[model samples]
Target: MLFADDPGFPGLPDDFIQRGPAGIEAAAAALEHGKPIADIQQFACLPPFRRAGKILCVGLNFAAHAKEAGMATPDYPTVFARFNSGLVGHGQPLIRPRSSDQFDYESELAFIIGRRARYVSEESALDHVAGYSILNDGSIRDVQLRTPQWTIGKNFDGTGGFGPDFITADELPPGCEGLRMQGRHNGDVVQDTSLSDMIFGVKKLVAILSAAMTLEPGDVVATGTPSGVGLSFKPPRFLKPGDIFEVEIEKIGVLRNPVVAEA
Candidate 1:
């Protein structure tokens, strides 16, 4: 089921299962509505969350990505938290923060929490998932490499470009393995890969994170990017004013954004 936070809290379209206000409430509501989910193409997309309490991001979740960066595969999941102030919508301008000279894009899949959860078992983690959305976890490669700490380079206002539409977790049909994630500049494809390469799947990520922190409704966890980041390329491809970047997650939707000079 899909819900929009537009001016009107519109009802779930005829094609969607109705989910209610609270994450689980909304899911239950969706099921009760007995409405077939409308084609997501029919209705406009909404931000994953109007506001989220926290946005946790994972790094190097893909082995190929780790190798591309000249780093060894992670000993364990590399986890970090992003500030909510960075969230932005699809097609929005991703301001190039003046504090850094290197900016890059990392295409990822993000999961929205349906309810409060702590120490949730992997078998039951899907129950707490509200749905899934796309994320362009933009980063400032310079700062990321400057210090051991990567937070400063990873989270910047307008850098978190996400959401054209979110589909309920249930709608993701079974046997739909290996999602293709790609990035484009103008019309050329720069990065492409299959989700099958992810070292840690969504279930395991939530299980590990839940053990360390309580994930509440609206919390988001970005699965992580594949190889082909600007910094990983020769001569390094970085975002500049007037440039446009588009991220596409197959079966979900596409998110397009233009680069702009930050004040």
Candidate 2:
């Protein structure tokens, strides 16, 4: 099944992803049958879970990134919220708001929850993940640092770049470890690291986050990016109009977006 309108898809309702592993199994079975979604490229690629209930993010989860930001690694996860208006799909433009010139790029791993989880333990946290995707945590640095809470700067319309494809959790290594994540700007590789460098792994994140809130199916979490953000550079190379940034994660795919100045 490819399109949202694939009603004939077996074993799931319209919001199939919310159905968890059963939904994935249905789709995988179709794929195995060589029933590839025809003319898929003719459609625009949106976030696989476009109607996600909550979009959560982590900051300072990568020790190197925390050090680069001149901040200490926190005892607890640095959690944040990203509203719907802030994110755009792959190939969409990432708007650099006129409010500030510190538009920057961050390439990171993101995952979708597949089960209801509240106060779940790390041992069972990964079982709740349905699939994983790539997220470009585009940033407006000046405004982001202006406040203790980064809500405003991070929530500008069309800044967060997400999607391309969502890979089933079974396809990737447990906790998405050993995968390499790369952030390329205008075809030049800027940020590079192993997913293993994450100070807080996926299981740890899911467990910690679920303790504070009930993580529902279809909720997405953009795991924090590593070091090499523009803010840490000597001259601070921020994104501008006409620039293109690409986030490529091993085994998943690349999520590429161009930079555009806000009208």
Candidate 3:
């Protein structure tokens, strides 16, 4: 979606999924023949798409991340929720909250569900995916570890970096497997791993999550991050003002954001 005065699909409603996959295909065809859309750099990016509902996140789905965090890789995926208010799009700033100085970054691949699904099986879970995007699951380390529950630390306003664009599933391999995932801090490569390293892949996550609740179109599921978060460092290098963080997933695209202290 192009971010402009009006923002998003010109003729359609802001919620692109109202018309479903066929609508997206039609929009693609129109864009090919119609006048060009503005270059993304010309405008402020919003999350590849907006989901007014659930934003489910997976934790420690990467073995290395679990190891670095000093937690056992769970038999089931570690799940958490992030409010939409916490997210900003490409070129936006990730606010380092004043409540905590231990801000951290987790690079992850997130997928949007295109269809309503409940009690789905792993074999059919991928069918629910409409598209995929990148997310910097930004965290406030101190608050995140304050209690057994992580929602508070994770939901800090403007901390989550989401999107540049949503790449439809057709443009990616099934379940987005084998892709490379990387995170950079101020242009320095800090985290790098293969999507294959994820302990619970997309299909399994979908199956597990859907069994518990319905996943609707536009609902997002972030599939967790590989190691190299700020908190994983020996001295714990937390994010500070002026820091630029990036999350890049091969085939999906890159999500870049600058860090700014909360005013």
Candidate 4:
């Protein structure tokens, strides 16, 4: 619910996800009766959480993706860190830094935590998930590979595309398996795969990550992308200015963004 709709609240607060399950349910109930915006489409859709907590991104969690990238199947999830500064809302422009022309795309399954969980068991991990969404997880090839550390290359402002909607966890199958995920560049399908193909599914990721650190409400765990990433092609099809990239997951609507050169 918008703060403008409720004067009891002063200004806007950025911690919607931190509201916990009960608060979230109350808000959802309130929004159900609120007057709908006649022109919501014209409004830029923000990422579901606005500012989600720790973005624990997993890498090489897809077997085919690891194979295509010439990496072996990881016995443990290759976790990485991502900041919200690099995220762009749906229909927003994803800046392609002029510093490099090797920008790439990754379409992955991302989920939000609904509970504060630590030392959670894999069998009980689903109870901690609030909802599921999509992550394009954009990458800067040369820079990403420059070092064993992917932080610098993975974080270019406006490269990542997030949101359009946040489908409640109950809406999807357990662990989001059986769903198809695809990535497109300017309407051309580049990557295609099934969610069941992930090396580390949602349950495992939640249990494993939370075991190391407390997984609080709103933390986003991106479950890695499949094969067919730009770098896997004979001649990489890196993104360029004027391009339109999309990440579409079955059951979850598509998230689209336009590409523009950094000024």
The TM-scores of all predictions, comma-separated, are: 0.83, 0.92, 0.93, 0.93
Pick by lDDT: which candidate is best?
3
Model 2 CA RMSD to the hidden true structure, in angstroms: 2.5
Ranking of models by lDDT:
3, 2, 4, 1
Local distance difference test, per candidate?
Answer: 0.76, 0.85, 0.86, 0.85
Question: Residue-wise lDDT of candidate 3 within 178-200, one digit each (tens)?
Answer: 99988999999999999988899
Candidate 1's residue-wise lDDT over 7-109, tens digit each?
3234442112223334344445545645466554344344557567778999999998999988889867998888767767776788899987688888888
Candidate 2: stretches off by over 4 Å: 1-14, 30-44
Q: What are the per-residue Cα lDDT tens digits for candidate 4 across 1-263?
A: 34565733322123545676766676666666656777443556767655666998999988888998999999999988999999888888889999999999999888999889999999899999988888889999999999999988999998998887788888899999899999998999998898999889999999999889999888899999988888888788988999999899998878888899999
What lDDT score goes with residue 31 in model 2?
51
Q: State how far residue 148 of model 2 sits from its true place (Å).
A: 0.7
Clashes of each: 12, 0, 0, 0
Residue 183 deviation, candidate 1, in Å? Answer: 1.3
Give the Å error, residue 16, model 4: 3.7
lDDT at 93 for candidate 3? 92
Kindly give the stretch of ten consecutive residues in candidate 2 with the minimal lDDT sum: 5-14
Model 2, span 25-69: residue lDDT tens: 776775564555665334446665667789999999889899989
**CA deviation > 4 Å runs, candidate 1:** 1-46, 174-176
Model 3 TM: 0.93
Model 4 worst lDDT run, 10 consecutive residues = 7-16
